[model samples]
Target chain A: MQQMNQILRRIPVWAVYLIGALPAPWLFYQGLTGGLGVNPIEALEHRYGELALQLLIGVLALSPLRRFLGLNLLKFRRALGVLTFTYVTLHLLVWLVLDVQVPSQIWADIVKRPYITVGMAAFALMLPLAVTSNNLSVRKLGPRWRSLQRLVFPAAILGGLHYVILAKGFQVEPLVYLSAIVVLLMLRMPISGVLTRTRQADST
Target chain B: GVGLAGMAQGAAAQETLEPNTWEEITSYNNFYEFGTGKDDPAKYAGALTTEPWSVKIDGLVDNPGDYDFKDIMSEMTVEERIYRFRCVEAWSMVIPWNGFELADLLNMAGVQEGAKFVAFETALIPDEMPGVRYPILEWPYREGLRLDEAMHPLTIMATGIYDRPIPNQNGAPLRLVVPWKYGFKSIKSIVRITVTDVEPPTSWNMSNPREYGFYSNVNPNVNHPRWSQASEREIGGGLFAKRIPTLMFNGYEKEVAGLYEGMDLSQYY
Candidate 1:
């Protein structure tokens, strides 16, 4: 814990921002320049999806890190969450621009294609959470703020489901994401094993 | 002129393989890369390395031998034709493929009388293609065709696409593209083509034999238990258009469906 805290302190906030945002432009550059070579659009979609999913995972990991590692670095969560939304938005944009140029087709894709439907559902769920994540909304919502923000958990779950539904087979990769969400959600539950561990720790 | 050469090759290849439309040719795909997505081949296959490669031809062929990938390319004139690559997953693509007829290559291999099936293997190095490393299925990659299907005119020894040598990700060097069958039946980065009496197991079919079959002829009536094959989305054609009705034998029914006239495709599919 001490070592992690030390490393965290040494790492400048600017470094994290730069590191996180670095790929955004680089991927964008790839898209603009046609660096994807043979299958440019697919390459764009694949990278955008991967980045969005990773950001979602990062958001899920935040709380566990705070509790287990004593890293109360709460300030980064909002930015992290925003970055996740940004990538998801880009993923959608790329799909719209490259794959679905027509509005009717876009609507049809949302209606058809189970994977696309799940992804659209997750994206829609994320919008409210992203909007409510601001301090202004939190202040406006008051005690209701926490309840509103808690939607992120479900949003993340749906995002993961969207990914799993698109994967080739029900292999272990998707299962890992599902497991992580389960752990994160369990950490929030009052009656879970994590609560038992915390209670035992306090007594000790 | 290159145009004349291409036209001549296209003409010869047509009798030997499925002649494709420009839309069908450009939008089609092979499932060797991008893990079975119709759009995946256009993107991920660029990472494939096709040059300086060799194909190991084995099994029951009388003229079993290994040849340089380029040697084969030189032996056959590469012709560009558009093919509608219909995936079993219901999505489709019109791909412009550059290669020669599979019949020409099969005749060169000199199959033995008893050889009833032609099983082909893809060069699936798990380290290179991380997707293969996953325990997704029993084997790395595999595809096969019954003897008559193997000898069919539409089967082509494909190497290049988009008017150039195929980008590595699309199966550089050489691969088999069976236009009428679903994309998976069109084996990519072919390391070997084996003639065998025993029905060789295919990657998807082996993973789920009932879902995939040895004679995976393109038929709309026969649906993959997992998804309907009755309709297909022509990839890169545009997102606006919904899936079109899949034709029996991928529109080569006039010539090939007679081969399976009485045979129940649903049972065989």
Candidate 2:
């Protein structure tokens, strides 16, 4: 366990980027080869959305995993954040270019449909975090950088909410993911002060 | 036309309908009685016993009894009718169905006076159907059509596809095929048919009346509240293919337009 943690700590962020990129080629191969059964466009959109949500949840879970379990995955959190944004952007593009296929209708759907509205809101929230997720911004902004990054929590919540609303009828899977995010947020509230102290120590 | 006359017209029917493969039809389906997933029906519907099927015809009809499957087949003349099947989800497919007109089946039972509507019921085998385990919809999926609509030549009781018996997942033995209305209106695996003076309560309308109406005619103008009805994707029309504009009454407007001439479709819908 100690050796594993040491390896995780020492691992390059580029490795994370490479590992995160593995699914894209596989998905593209499936899409091009007609492996995505029946409706490949819909399948691609759903998968990218799911991957984005999963990575967002992973980003939310990082602090709790480090604080409680004495295991740290903090170094890769920025990479995870950027990868989540990449997936979300891909998901949106697929919906725009492949599924709806009309600029006017796409704008109408984003504005009119509650599910799309929430999903777009979630994607919009992730934008600032993705932009400022760098060492230069961290050094320049200092304490404000952490505050700006807190958007991840709301982004995660909205992402989960988007999934819940998109489901046709009563579905348990999205609810389960939403509940997990809620619990993670609740777990986060009590240790907020401790989080600041740990961060200060890391910077020193 | 009956028997050999209907069989001889198969070539003419093939010309109008764009053919879909049996693989495409079998794989992609929405039989919610089995499950909500598109592929769920095929995986779980093998448990359904289709051979010993009997449909109970009741209500205002003169002949009210459990009609055997074999008897129903022997009495009616089956024909291949190529139809455009549109779902409420805004996806569609062209299917070549083999069955007799639903009016012929009603005529066999002798439609009594004052029968305004024809109500149909799906088989309620809780053991065979996983979806029945949930209250996502009321058990024994029910759908109905106006007597005039039911008697239309386009309304058929499908038993076969591509010269073979329909797979259990695709509503085997007997299923209603109303080409003009949304696909769900054509209730699958029908176990009961009732003629009534009043409109029957359909499953989707009862589940959520706002989104789903009793008369789910395909209209591009009237949106589905959540999604646009302006266009639809054909199932076998390729992954990246553009969605074509949806037609009024799914292109059967000429045949069915006269039925609802006096009534307000927007209000009724």
Candidate 3:
């Protein structure tokens, strides 16, 4: 166990992010190769889109979890966020190129459909977060790093709302992600006698 | 002496204006004001003001009266009709509708001269309806039919379905039934029926003219801007993509196409 701990301690953060994402590409490739049996196309799109939102919410919960639960799992949040962008890109590519063969229709759908508009907005917000997750970029910006990373909360809410309205029903599976995000947000609220030092600094 | 016989002939013709094949009438509907989904209108329409219902008969009707909802349904015996409902959105349902022909009630109300168009409106009530909370669609749904279309043998006012009083969800008290057209053409929970000289504004056409039109017939040839109309999936089927070919006038070409003589359906659509 001690040897294992030593090995893990020496592994670079970037290397952990790369190694952790090994399963995503395999799942994507399996979908591409027609592994999903019925409604393979729709199933492929659902899996990628669903995972993107799940990982996004997971990343949003990290900092708060570390502070309250005394768990520092946020070490993996940067990697998970970048992984979300990768899956979102794949989802958008499959939908734009495969489902809507007509280019004009795709353009029209993005503009006309409310669900698509919010979905695109969520993806746009992720681009910057993924880019700045690295230590080098975070160090370069200093204080601005915290502000930029804070966007994950709203982005997560938008992604959840997008899926909810598009579904048009209270589907149990997708509702789980929405409920999780809500609980995570609720966890961050300052209960009685439990204010953070940052809150005190801002007040001054 | 010739005047007496002329009155008798007119009465005979009016009596047969109602349908012999009720199946063709009940399966058709106009629940699309709720959503494009086949089950949505029925599920959403339950909140409509079905209780304490009254319809105003005005404009070119001689005996206009505030008819009680139940009294109007009791005007004729209910017939059972099992039909395949086709939607403009490319979905379908096989429903057993129980109701009477609309022409019988219209003639009883005494339609007068120059009654060329039959315009209808849903009882607009926002208080009970949760869907109205959001402006997902225009309120007080409207639909219209030409004079001949209104008097056609296939036109009906459905009161029940699946051998029971029409469920509140499926336009409880009274719902229009016009076979040969897509289901949305059949308006539900009607509050007013106006017999006028000109065509009136329909809900879908007024909201999205490019997507829906006034004379929205069931023609597989004309595709909706968002979806293909050539095929439809039956309700209660699993998520398989299997679809059946849609028929022109929903398989009522023998009775209806003769009415629109020489007009271009594609243009009107």
Best by DockQ: 2
Please provide, for model 2 over B204-244, each residue's C-alpha lDDT reduced to its tens digit, 9 standing for 90 to 100: 89977888888999989888878889999887766686899
Candidate 2, residue B63: the lDDT equals: 91
Better model by lDDT: candidate 1 vs candidate 3 = 1
Best by TM-score: 2
Each candidate's TM vs. the true structure? 0.68, 0.90, 0.60
Which lDDT tens digits does candidate 3 get at residues A58-120? 777777765644456656766778888887887888667544445765676677667787888
How well does chain B match by TM-score in each candidate?
0.83, 0.94, 0.83
Backbone clash total for model 3 is 2
* Residue ranges of candidate 1 with Cα displaced over 4 Å: A1-26, A102-112, A169-176, A189-204, B1-100, B104-116, B123-132, B159-173, B189-199, B208-269
Off by over 4 Å in 3: A1-204, B1-49
For model 1 the local lDDT of residue A158 reads 82
DockQ of the two-chain complex in candidate 2: 0.47
TM-score-best of 1 and 2 = 2
